[model samples]
Target: MPPMPARIIHTSIARDWREVYAFMADHEKMPLWASGLSAGLTREGEEWLAPGPLGNARVRFSPDNDYGVVDHLVTLADGQQVHNALRVVPNGDGAEVMFTLLRLPGMSDAQFAEDAAWVEKDLASLKSILESSKA
Candidate 1:
């Protein structure tokens, strides 16, 4: 299969990389910044169930680690799994958070652009929340 087009949407935060990672590593806190999970997530065993575009979706997050990685796989109702790659790394005294978005099969140019814009907006939301919070 051919590689899908990808976009690395990111934002800079005026906070320590470790601090940013710590805040984002908590799955339950996603709803605070992630509009996609604005309806919130419910933990069921190891996976989390969140309201999807179509229906409830199961989300499996990457295990905790010293390195900053907040990857997750969202399983849609139709069993389509979308893998989201997120990372936090040092940017001088601040931090840089990045999210990789892929243009899936059958997606149109307009749809892909919209998805990228959504990711950019979400990252901005995250930056706002973290930057405004007390360290």
Candidate 2:
């Protein structure tokens, strides 16, 4: 199968870049926008576990300061596992978010679409929260 296409979403936040970056990097604030991510645990290294509404999964963060990339292993309640990579790039005033979901051998196209939608929604929510908090 062809490599999964990356979905890109852009939104402007009124807050400064530092505030926006801090909020985005804060794993504890994920549940505010990320669906199914009920809680997150951060380790000293780049590895972390984000508990979904169904089950827990592992995440790996890329070692980069200018750009942020996260690899997510999501386990569905039915025991299905999906791997996805989320990348964030800071725009001049806001940010640009990208999600590259790796499709399993037997995964359907609809599943990829659904995951992309979820990521876009999460980004939108993040933009809303950051912009609304502007002083």
Candidate 3:
């Protein structure tokens, strides 16, 4: 069988890179950008809990860093661990946010495309919020 593909979705945010990264890294602000985390998050020990299709799942975000990397590992209620890749990079005076979506083993092309579209919409939401706040 062919391997699952890794796809990236990105958007230009009209905010300072540092500001964008800081907001993106904060779990509390995720509901403002990431729909998958819309139900909100709470930290417990080393992990964070959020609502998803699998119910309340434990997520451990990578420790804060200076290089703009914002990766996270989500542990599903049923024991599946999914690694989600995300990043923010400087773009002139603003920033560009990118989200990497992985196509799981059993997912079909259609399903993968759907996920990609979802990421695009989520990024747009992020862009809208960050950019509008500056206006």
Candidate 4:
């Protein structure tokens, strides 16, 4: 399967950039936005665990505030591995989030597409939460 390219999602929230960034970076708050996610980061050294309704997996994230990027590795429960990257850029009134979910050697394209769609919906929920909180 071909590696999935970065999917960009943009939205305007009433909250400030700092608040928006903080909300996104807070792992514990993921289930509040992400669908079917039961818990957030479970760290073991540099690696972090992300558990959802599907299964539990480990990933490593290196945050670069200067470049507004996070380098990560997404390892499937069955031993498949994919290198992922996320970049958050400040827009005119809000922020644009880009997620690059690379295709692993044995990963199916259909699964990747499904996951991408879920992520898109998650971001939309996040935008709504942030915008509504400001009102």
Winning model by lDDT: 1
Write down the TM-score of every candidate: 0.96, 0.67, 0.92, 0.71
Report the lDDT tens digits of candidate 3 across residue range 1-135: 475589888999879999999988878899888898889999899899998886898989989999899899988888888888899999999998988898888889999999999899999999998888852
Off by over 4 Å in 2: 40-46, 68-83
Q: Residue 23, candidate 3: how far off, in angstroms?
A: 0.8
* Candidate with maximal TM-score: 1
User: How well does candidate 3 score on lDDT at residue 15?
Assistant: 92
Q: In candidate 1, which residue ranges exceed 4 Å CA deviation?
A: none
Quantify all predictions' global Cα lDDT against the true fold: 0.92, 0.63, 0.88, 0.67
What is candidate 3's TM-score against the reference?
Answer: 0.92
RMSD of 3: 1.9
Assess the local accuracy of residue 56 in candidate 2 as a C-alpha lDDT between 0 and 100: 62
Which pairs of residues have clashing backbones in candidate 3? none
Alpha carbon lDDT of residue 9, candidate 2? 47
Off by over 4 Å in 3: 1-3
TM-score of 1: 0.96
- Taking the tens digit of each residue's C-alpha lDDT, what string does model 2 give over 28-98? 67678776564656564656776666566666544435545544655455666667666566667656556
C-alpha RMSD of each candidate structure in angstroms? 1.0, 3.7, 1.9, 3.3
Better-scoring candidate (lDDT), 1 or 2 = 1
lDDT of 1 by residue, 1-135 (tens): 699999989899999999999999988899988889989999999999999679999999999988899999999999998999999999999999999999999999999999998889888988998899863
Q: lDDT score of model 3?
A: 0.88
